[model samples]
Target: MAPHTRYTRLAEEALSPAHSVIATSQTYDGAAPFPDFPDDDRPAPARSGGERLQVAVTALIVTLPFLALGLAAWLLWGTLIRPTDALLALALYVITGLGVTVGFHRGLTHGGYRAGRPVRIVLAVAGSMSFQGDVIGWVATHRRHHAFTDRPGDPHSPYRYGTHLRGQLRGLAHSHVGWLFRNDPTPVERYAPDLLADRDIRAVSRAFPALCVLTLALPFALGWAIGGTWLHATTALLWAGLVRIALLHHVTWSVNSLCHVVGRRPFRTRRHDRATNLWPLALLSFGESWHNLHHAEPTSARHGVDRGQIDPSAAVIRLLERLGLVRDVRWPSPDRIATHRT
Candidate 1:
């Protein structure tokens, strides 16, 4: 029985030993450490006062460059919006935001679908452009979210505090952007072992900072090549770089905050989770606004499973499938949809 039990638990144990192991250790290496398991389960120490202060201060500092650029745009460009700059920013934002939604969240994090080698590479690069942490880190945090949605261990749940208005506001703030400073990052080995095993994903993740620079710099380079001026490049940097990122950031955070707070709940979700579809954010979030369906069917390839729900991400997936770039997509079926539907 012991040997059979061990073999049965091998896969789950490899992923999260704590969940499979039921025993405890008195002490090891001068501290308590479980034996017979090769994983660590201790909660990482929270940030110190100074570290937290530094993060808050740094967040404040980052706003200055964008503010300065905004001021420049007001004084120099006047009220006239440049078509070229707007187009460039629009293109970049769409490409990069899809990378996070279709690539990082759906593909990498949830295994909702599989992409061919070329598609995988392109998605990875696109996600890198979004300037979120590497693929491994993103997957880790996301898997943690699914594992403990709206619960204590979740990385960014809006219900962490309480149900009062002030508490919800505080929780919303934390889930939006404040948690980055306080929450300990999810361990890649435990949550994203598959990604860590892949050399290409690791390489891309390790080079994330460089990719972010390229994300910002490429627009400027394109602008310079087209308009033949440093000023044009600067404008591209502002519209495409700062504004685009700000837009994506707010929308993504809304999925963590607003999705849980407001909108229509048309699908049944686990108790205590209030994910809903906020229609206004649909286009901006690239079809991610079908929050109720998403929480109800996390790995379904399409979140917008009903009428009047626009899902650009699903369209992209369909295009890729038509191009023979993705296979075995776990699209929602009528039976499954009916089962989970409200």
Candidate 2:
């Protein structure tokens, strides 16, 4: 057996009985039941244990080269330290990194803040560099996750399996990258109609592959311009290119795996979800570690609402508002926060 289309199967099994309105299903009548529920019938592909393990092992192996390079760099730091290299790494990291946190996650996925037309396009392009996927695709998948959460339909939830250690480890790996290879993708029409309807956004989404190439190439180009050597270019490519992306991937995925599986859920969510605020990823994930608050109040501009919590993404939104590039901000009120407290 295999999974069929998400809405199709869902409508057939649980739509009318559960609710009068079918948001994802196309069929609608003023006073009649849905006559056509999409038959969620699809072929089930088979894979050997060795083949599955091969995928897991390959993910591990792909990361090793970057780890080795980082170790080597650390070992030779003083001798190899170069001002240009340091600056290059910092610039790329901040630009591309914030592009993911601010642009992809907050702007596209949740609509936490609105950017001006120019900023919106630029952020979309920058986010494409992180190589997650196009803005529309990413938004659709993420919205689906929020809609279903840790329940049966969640695209990636660590709690899908039991809470044992082995289950946790396996679920963690699945949420991190294994879900990408899965056949199912969120139905964009249902989940991301707003993004799909925008022409400029569609243009950027279509250019994603080219943007990914530009992302990897730009660092080396800058390195060669500054250091005037192939060696510097190679090192820049390694550290700011592969290593930067690898680090970002894990940090972003940790929100799905580690945040769900551990940390403190101070706020109440749908009974099924176990969102938590894991402090260590706060800065790296741009205050997205305040996952519990986010799941509790998805559209709110600020996630780090606690006394000492720091949300850089919210800070960026504030700055954008100051510049008049973003408006209709939705900062969470203390009263609202208190209401959601568990």
lDDT of 2 by residue, 104-178 (tens): 777767666667678988888888887677888887778777765665456787754546677667777878776
* Top-TM-score candidate index: 1
TM-score of each: 0.83, 0.81
What does candidate 1's lDDT look like per residue over 1-342, in tens digits?
332132223222332324523233222221121231222456556688976875766475346444746665685554665678889989998999999989887777766677866777789889888766677788778776765556545667776566677777788888887677664556778777777867778888988878878988988898898889998888888777777776777788889888988899988876555789999999999999888898888777799988889999998988888888887777999899999877
Score each candidate by Cα lDDT: 0.73, 0.72
How many clashes (backbone N, Cα, C below 3 Å) per candidate? 0, 0
User: Where does candidate 1 stray beyond 4 Å?
Assistant: 1-77
Candidate 2 residues lying further than 4 Å off, grouped into runs, are 1-81
Assess candidate 2 and give its TM-score to the true structure: 0.81
Model 2 / residue 308 / CA error / Å: 1.1
Q: Kindly state the number of residue pairs that clash in model 2.
A: 0
Residue 132 accuracy (lDDT) in model 2: 70
Cα displacement (Å) at residue 3, model 1: 28
- Pairs with backbone N, CA or C atoms under 3 Å apart (clashes), candidate 2: none
